[model samples]
Target chain A: MLKKDPNFTRLKKLGGRGYLGRVSYWLGVDHLLVVEVTNYNERYRRFYFRDLQAVIVQRNRNRMWGNIVAGVIAILPALGALALLSDGEYAGASLVGGILVLIGIFILSNTLRGPMCSVHLRTAVQTQKLANIDRWRRAEFLIETLTPLIQSLQVSAGEAQSPNPATVSNPPAASAVQPDFS
Target chain B: MSTASNNVLNCPNCGKSLSDLPEMLPAVERCPACERQTRVVVFPAFSRPVVKGATAEAVMMEGEATCFYHAKKRAQVPCDECGRFLCAVCDLEVNGRHLCPQCLETGAKKGKVQSLERGRFRWDQVISTLLVLPLISCGFLLPLTSLAALVLVVWKWKSPPSLVHNTRLSLIVCGVLALIEFIGGCAFWWFMLFGSRRY
Candidate 1:
């Protein structure tokens, strides 16, 4: 049987984008998880092995409409510039067209990225979304690593509370069959 | 990858090992060994320390600044909100914002700061509700109520942010409803004058 250790080591670093699009990291611990939302704010939540209700991983695909709308808005000025140039306004046409094309490229590059995966820890009190663990591989690895430790902890906790097997099995057969009101 | 049998969880009521439990948590199962029931909950484990090289340094000299929360501890950083010097233990960093416990608590209670807030009041939804509901129940006061709703929508267009990502659907609905009411009022007035003359 494995003994419980008080000194916790970080098993995994979950990384994700935080508020105002800042990259943040969280520390996965055996009994406690520390989420660093920003430079000054950190949330620490402790859970017993028997208290954690669920660990959920959800995949969110990038919305194409946002990219499409951005692309369309970006090209609007360029299209307007084309109309102006056809009407013999060369200066206005060139300036607007150049700016719009650059803006469009910038939006397109950012929007071309793949979907993001998010990890969530649900307990009796509340469900916390681990913003830092956004990648599927990392999230999966965290789940895999923690499952055994949780199982071990549960087993140990259970054993500590349970009565001896020998004592339980050796009860008199007559006493087991008879219902005691007391 | 470790198999289920490698670290089998036992029933809390019984010493018997439980095998093949479902992945979903908060499950109730009868222990075969003891004929008693137990609820199974699971948590992930950590093998290493998450925060590396984070240790509270001692206050060395008498002249050096000390933490406001802990006077004996050496001050490492200043709280972003209150500008109070904080030790390593007192400095709570959230999304690049360094804050002391007092400021954190205050921000959470008042909902002034977005990072500290758990939920937010959606003004757009309020505006939309006010605009649409008045028109349905009080058709006679459509012009007055819708105008007031429009004014509110414009005034509180950028009120407190929502807990979840908002698409401004409520604002759009309010705008549409307000416009319809305004146009209907104008049409009604026009008909009252011109149609009366025609009759």
Candidate 2:
């Protein structure tokens, strides 16, 4: 429901704090529905369930952080090897150090490249939950607005269909001619 | 809104039209014209889609009528080799394909399975320790501190159960570097301090 709103488009375009602010606002709405409602079994299915697209976006964003960290790790080995080469005395120690540093850098780089969807899946689920809460709120508003119209229809129908006036009158002899109010 | 009857279904006994009957009521109901209870049954009654079959325990049969696994108590999956019944739990997803439990067991015992052991290690710490170890022998305190750093890196690398290869590599590198640093430092001290005095 939040995604459908034009305001979301504007917020997304704004970027920076605006994007983060919109996401947090939607998250708050989702949190409210999760906490307040007790009977909506379909809420999770309709709103909070993780879809594939959302999962992919989340993973892509998360991997950027891992990549940056890996890049930083890669720097260490290069720097260490350079330092060891400059110090000619500890040649044996330097070789072992160089190998270990290089291996660590390789592992970090490999892990950064590998496929990881856990982070993305988690964020998608959260977003879906927020959307479900927004849908529930709209459904409640419709019900509240329509209830009075239904009651009016019931009253009008009752007035039109009453038993014949001649049979089983309210008072035994009270006629239209007298119209007494005692 | 109301529409004209698409097809007139009349009661057999009274010939009274049954098309105007309420949608909520069963299609076959008593005809007032006959003053007796009668039914107007249709071949394809206007009921919701029948997702389950007549048995109700299994899904409605579709193209090719696959067998249902009574033991597993699920449906819609067929074995790869033989088109027999197999539920998802009983099905093995292998090498871009689905194989039944029997096939999976045979394949596993035949050593046709891939070992999934992707390990994690702190590459930064290992590299740092190794690099620092060689520098340790330049001064007595440098080697001591670098040895401590190497021990820490090895410990951290070995903590996780998955990444043994990466951890072992780092450990070996750090240990050898530390040993070399200690021995080289001792040799240098002996040559400078004692060799000159003896001469």
Candidate 3:
């Protein structure tokens, strides 16, 4: 069994929920931990800050498609409400307008949530897509938070660096790794 | 060199190459071919070469400890799991333990090492689904499905469990559900065959 690291803090606003599973992020001193849980079983992936190559956030048209579908389906109730209002049936109009309002709320929330995005992390050997982090805002937060930590660790570890030494992002406080069992 | 790194970070949606854009780190650009917006953040390791592991030194003394795998190679550390002496080349450090190749593989198979575990079958989900699906889809098949669920749950009760929450409660629920379905199915069948009918 994988023991939970007390030192590893769960990243704020870094969790994904889906019908199948959930993906959550935990930050260790030197590495980032991604835990994926499905049907009560968990899988873990660790990416050391020093080994990370890049993080790419790609914006997609999922919101537009969602809006289009919802709008098409909502047209009937909207027309019904308008027709009822024209016929002077205030109660019927209000009842029909309620459905349109619910649909409007859904569309408004989708827009408020902003555009959809997909985030992928690249390493020397592998590039893994973050299944849960599909928002540009969350992706930006990851980049802003991670870029500095990775730069500092690589520089401190004496790994090859192309970035300037003085401007390396200040790493989050480092915690001591657990003692060896051997 | 820059193009090589950009090649792998292609458009996730349309599978088009975004490398044609100007050379800049931490920049957002729209893929010309796919017209999708993409944000790229490159770290320092993006341009660095892969660091190689240290090689084992040859035995210089007549009585020097040797690697468990390689007899002539000098031993530098012992494996955390197996306690076998390992040379620098043979020592595989993961999470913090200095494990030999064999112990690492064994740990991976036995699920002792967290890094290597990729997936696990949730028996509770399996048993629960088996017990519920038949009742919802085909009520007549409940007896057979419930019997199967009961047998499998009892059989796998002592096996390796799910990682997070204790599945004992779920198992009990599954067992009870399965038992109820089985008894109901049997009673219905008995009534059909033996009970009086008002026709």
True contacts kept of each: 0.06, 0.00, 0.45
List the global CA lDDT of all models: 0.56, 0.38, 0.75
**Model 3 chain B weakest lDDT span, ten residues long:** B1-10
Query: Residue-pair clashes per candidate, as listed?
Result: 20, 7, 0
Pairs in steric clash, model 2:
A47-A128, A47-A132, A48-A128, A48-A129, A101-B127, B119-B163, B136-B143
lDDT by residue for model 1 (A19-133), tens: 6333333223435444333332333344445445445554443335556677777777868998998999999998997888787776666455433455666554455666556
Error of 3 at A34 (Å): 3.4
Best by DockQ: 3
What tens digits encode model 1's per-residue C-alpha lDDT throughout B1-199?
1111222444433446544443322243444576442333344321111223345678899889998977788999999999999998888886569899899889878866644444345566556666667667876666776777788777877665432224266676777888788778667767777878988
Give stretches of model 2 more than 4 Å off: A1-51, A55-182, B1-87, B90-119, B122-127, B133-138, B141-183
Candidate 3 residues lying further than 4 Å off, grouped into runs, are: A1-12, A19-21, A27-30, A37-43, A75-99, A144-156, A159-182, B1-23, B27-36, B60-63, B164-166, B195-199
- Tens-place lDDT per residue, model 2, A1-182, is 33444422211211122221212122211111121111111111122211111111111223445556656766766576667667764775477576766667666664544432211111211322222112212323322332233223323432463424333212111001111112
Model 2 lDDT tens row, B16-115: 6534643312333334465333222121112211122123134344443444545524455677756667654556566556677776776555534422
Candidate 3 CAPRI level: acceptable
In terms of lDDT, the poorest run of 10 residues in model 2 chain B is: B41-50
Per-residue CA lDDT of candidate 3, range B45-67, in tens?
Answer: 66544445688999999999999
Error of 3 at A133 (Å): 1.5
Worst 10 residues of 1 chain A by lDDT: A172-181
